[model samples]
Target: MQATQPLVGKETAFITGGASGIGRATVLRLAEDGFRVVVIDRNALQVEALVAELVQAGYDAVGHAVDVCDRSKISALIDAEARVDVMVCAAGIGPSCAFDAISDEDFRAVLEVNVLGVFIASQEAVRRMKPGGRVVTVSSRAALGGGGFAHYVASKAAVVGLTRAMAMDLRQRRIAVNSIAPGFTDTGMTRAMTPAQHAAASALEPAGRPAEPHEIANAIAFLASPRTSFITGQTIFVDGGKSLGGLGL
Candidate 1:
């Protein structure tokens, strides 16, 4: 790993949806960057393994299993954990189906996890963070457009809006809030697709490839760092330029 950045030392970051995928990558990135990391995820095994790995590596890391939709659990967790300098709300689900095909339960569930999850997590994080703290939420490039996945796109768009609003709301306290709008990437969720499906999805990228998990983690690290003090209320696209070309070409 590269030398840990100075802004990362002696600080703590709380992350949600951290058992696997982008959350796991962010946890490792933050740990490697010298921040004490606490992750909340629904996957007990994955969370436990990650925590153990970080411990063995001489880094401060712990994991909690909780549903992000539950406000009481979130409040209790934050109360127990006390203060954190950074919070990354990366817990979300993407159910891509046509608008009419989206069932009521599925639509609500997606909204709860993607939009309300960020709202609840950010609310708790703001309460626990110091004045110069940072909050980075994981939005999606779907926020910029609405197409095949109407429910997912709607929920993620709310994330972007919430991020911007929170940035304004938190600015007075010197706490920066931002969101990362990532394009397609190869994750466990995306692993369900056929090779042809994955290739076709990735082929839309102007950069000609899907992003690696580490790439997004690096962007989160940058946003969470004190060095990004001047940056806030923005959605940084780490999406390999896919958003630029909506065409299937």
Candidate 2:
């Protein structure tokens, strides 16, 4: 592990999977909170576009093309800056396949990116964080369990577990580790559903609509904020009551 650097001027926030979806939304939200964000994604084109967009908005930002599951790539990234104030572990991929039909390779790929990827990112990022540093990870409401997405759900559950463990380990360092479990979010991933399927799926939620990326971003922003120091190892459900299942809360 590398020696962590002290945070300097213009607090820096780095986000994995930041080129699109929830991660992209997090980048913009943190930038608004005055972070010079570094967006990481394997999609070079999307990363470039996001960087350009941020610059156009007069925010300090940059892009890195990297895979979160690649330890070597991530090791190189852990030293990206002198100090990292916040790291959003948002890189994940969840593919759907029937339980019986799910290939070992396919399941492994999902876990690699969704589970191991978060672990690697958090491990490196936390090692590089200063005291009061923050890590906001993206889990899923499905971690509570659902049908048809065993691999993804299991991976997300792993994330929640990892979050608590990380919080305990980093407690002495004053680093907050937390996660957000989003449900029925409107994104490219949801867009893959047929229009009717999408609508019907969202209707199942008490909110009666899928969450916009920015809505979930709001949760990430709050968790990553310096003000959230007292809140650690908690999974904030941004899933619009879907986690409740008819239990009035």
Best by TM-score: 2
Candidates in order have lDDT scores of: 0.85, 0.87
Clashes of 2: 0
* Model 2 worst lDDT run, 10 consecutive residues: 1-10
- Tens-place lDDT digits, model 1, residues 6-41: 234368888999888888999999999988788899
Model 1 pairs in collision: none
lDDT of 2 by residue, 170-238 (tens): 999999999999998998888888899898998887878899999999999998899987789999898
Candidate 2 Cα deviation (angstroms), residue 245: 1.9
Q: Which RMSD values do the candidates have, in order?
A: 4.0, 3.6
What is the overall TM-score of model 1 with all chains considered together?
Answer: 0.92
lDDT of 1: 0.85
